[model samples]
Target chain A: MLDMIIDFFVIGAKIGLILLPLILAVAYTTYAERKIIGYMQMRLGPNRVGPKGWLQPIADVIKLLMKEVVVPSGSNKALFLLAPILFIAPSFAAWAVIPFDVELALANSDVGLLYILAMTSIAVYGVIIAGWASNSKYALLGSLRSASQIISYEIAMGFALVGVLMASGSMNLGEIVKAQDGGLLHWFWIPLLPLLVIYWVSGVAETNRAPFDLPEGESEIVAGFHVEYAGISFALFFLAEYANMILISVLTTLFFFGGWLNPFQGIPFVEEVTGWIPGIAWLLLKAGFFLFLMIWLRATFPRYRYDQIMRLGWKVFIPVTVVWLMILTFMIKAGVGPWFTGRGVL
Target chain B: MTVESVVFYLFATLTLVGAIGVITMRNAVQAVLCLVLTFFSAAVLWMLLEAEFLAVTLVLVYVGAVMVLFLFVVMMLDVDYASLKAGYTKYLPLGIITALALFGGIYWVIRSEVFGVEQMPEPAKHGADYSNVTELGRLLYTDYFFAFEVAGVILLVAIVAAISLTFRGRRDRRGQSVPMQHQASKEERLRVVSMESGPRQDGQEKTEKKKRIRRKKGGGS
Candidate 1:
């Protein structure tokens, strides 16, 4: 019993280690987004709070905490309160299987990939419930949009992951990363480039990020589903969204860009020098790049029209993934090149 | 009790509660939500059995995808609770009889003589390296390949039939041709007609002057 308690405490501390940094990252991501977009628009962003606006997210959090949580009259009180928790819980929970470095995860579940998928899928409930329980037409419309959009893109996203699974032949995230051990060229991104792009794009759409954020289209639906949410209740939804963005970025890094695996492997002098740098650092760098790319995309593109978004997800992305999956299968069967040579085919 | 049994009992109780909630809740949306809860609890129970693949797939396919769609439709529906409840008292005896019949049938199948601890002993726990997915995959592809393919084909046929039934390609319905939009050129949008500069006709000049004077008079007024 004493040993079990100690083990429990150890796990708790490890979870804290993952979550604390994750929360900080999510907070800073909002700051970075503002600063980045501000710079892109030829203006300064929140450089007013602390040194270089370092304390903006803190202030925001405090403000949200102090504010009153106004539950609209006639709203489903239970579900209204439950929505934010539902949204944020899965976003945080999906991090358990995400390998920071080799053998550095909370639970090294064999079905890590599917677990994440299931968790993400569950997040739709939060959006739907938030929208419905708000007892507002706009919120309902937003949730409806969100529900259909997520459902459509999820198919494409699943198919893309199927390609990754075929290439790596493992549902375990660690195994997937280990499969890409040789170098940068050995990464799944090269052979499964289309799938990677699809996955990244689908990830963006899945998170309801800028271009595909029809669910919360400010002009169209006035902040969409969580419009009725206030104070910390609202803050939870915000945290979930940003955290999900980071999650997508990290998954992209893991699945395609080689999580924790050094890109400088087999590069002679560079490899020797960079070998000392820890695997977690490489993982963070790759994930950060994708995060930056997501922001860059937000700054660059206009929000897609609702029908266009659906068309892209269903007609374009789904077909592309299917075709690429077939091609990948054929390549694996024929034993083509360095990629499909010795790796687990099916 | 052991931790596993405790967890099992907790989830089993939740499953029962959710099932009860599904039947008892007046609101359609609430009922659907209860159903989702039931599905999720059932999946957790599956996880306790160490059928991790099946558990996750249940959550993914049913709770995640199917339940969301179910909730979507349920939310959209304008259910008349009064009408739904009108026959409850009238059908009470019939409902109770049907329920009893279902219970009796289930009990008969699962009773101690046929399917109990002696008949179906607990499965041996596998090692840490034992992948349930790998074993399942092997069994599925080799032993039940034909059955699995047939099931997949049936699902495909249903999907095709559903799509065909609903898809109406009406020429009247205005839809954007995205490829055509992409292929659109500046020439198609705007034609720059180069015209030689010429002196204005006396009649045209007079009309222009009259219009300008009229505007001036209107402004003055």
Candidate 2:
């Protein structure tokens, strides 16, 4: 009994350790986005706070906390408040299953990938409820757009994951990384490039980031589902969105970019030197690269028009992912994967 | 008394409560949400039974997709909650009869030892690292292959049926062709011809001259 109690406490502490870093990362992701976007656009972004606005996220948090939370009249009060929690919970909850290092996971269950998928999928409720409960037509419209957009992209995204599942043959995130052990060339992206493209694109769409951000098209729908939200309520939604972006980036890294693995394992001196650095650093570097790509895309590309977004998701990405998945299925079944056979990701 | 039993009972109670909420809730959206809660709690109960794949897929399919879709429809439909309760007392006897019949049927099944507590013993406990997904997949592929295949085919048919029923291609609707839009040229859209500011020539006499002038422009020739 005493041992079990100690085990629970240890597990709790481990979870807290992961969560604190994750929350800090989430805060800094916003800061990094501003800085990167600023650099890209050749404008000074949020540099008024601490040195280079390092404390900008903290200031933003304080501002949100100090503001008054406004619930509109003729709104479903219960669900209005509940929406942000539903949205925020799943985004952070999915982190419990993420394997940062080889043995460092909170849950580390067999179905880590599916668990993440399920949690993210449930996040749609937040938008839907928030929109409906806002009692505003604009909010309703925004939420509806978010719902359809998420559902449409989810199909393509799910198919992309099917390709990864076929390649790795394990749903455990650690196993997925293990399967991709052989540096850059042996990464799943090489074999399943089409699926990788579909996955990454759908991931951006899933998170409702720029270009695919029809749900919150500020120009048209006035911030969409979150238009009616204010103060800390809106902050929760904001945090969830950024958190999801980080999640998607990490997931992309884990699924395709070979999470936490040295990209030059075969090279003699380089591999030995690279091995000295911890695996988590490699994972963060890859995920950060993807996150940077996201901000760059946001800075460069214009928001996607609504119909075009749908057409791309339903018509283009779906067929591409499905066909690629079929090809992948055959490739895996025939034992044709050169990466899997001899070296075993080295 | 045990942890498993406690968790199981907790989930079971919540499931029942959610089901009750589903029936009693005045708002249609709230009722649908209650149904979602019921489904989720039942999934938890299934997980307690060590059916991890079954439980996760339950949440994935029913709660994630089906309920959300249901919410989409429910939220769109402008239903007055007060009207939903109007016929409640009018159909009390019929409702009671149906409820009693369902309860009786369920009780009869449970009381009979065919699939009751006596016949259905607790499944053997697996190790901490046991993966039910692999086991389930093997069983699904081998022993239950035909049934699984049939289920998939039925789902495909259902999908086709639903699409056919609901999908209406609108000829009245005009949408932009992105590829055509992208392929469009400035010359195609705008012809910057420097014709004489006034009429080039007489009505009939200018036809040939107009053609010659257009040809000289070099784009439409």
Q: Judging by TM-score against the true structure, name the best candidate.
A: 1
**Residue A67 accuracy (lDDT) in model 2:** 97
Off-target runs (Cα >4 Å) in candidate 1 are A1-4, A343-346, B168-171, B187-221
**Candidate 2 residue lDDT tens string, B6-115:** 67888899999999999888888999999998998999998887888888888888888999999999988988868877998999999999999999998887775677
Q: Which residue pairs show collisions in model 1?
A: none
Say which candidate scores most in DockQ: 1
- Reference-based lDDT, residue A69, model 2: 94
Query: Model 2, which residues run further than 4 Å from truth?
Result: A1-8, A342-346, B1-6, B112-116, B193-221
For candidate 2, state the interface root-mean-square deviation in angstroms to 1 decimal.
2.4
**Each candidate: chain B TM-score:** 0.81, 0.78
Cα lDDT tens digits, model 1, A37-121, are 9999999999999999999999998999999999999999999999999999999999999999999888899999999999999
lDDT of 2 by residue, A51-153 (tens): 8799999999999999999999999999999999989988988898898889877887888888888888889999999999999999999999999999899
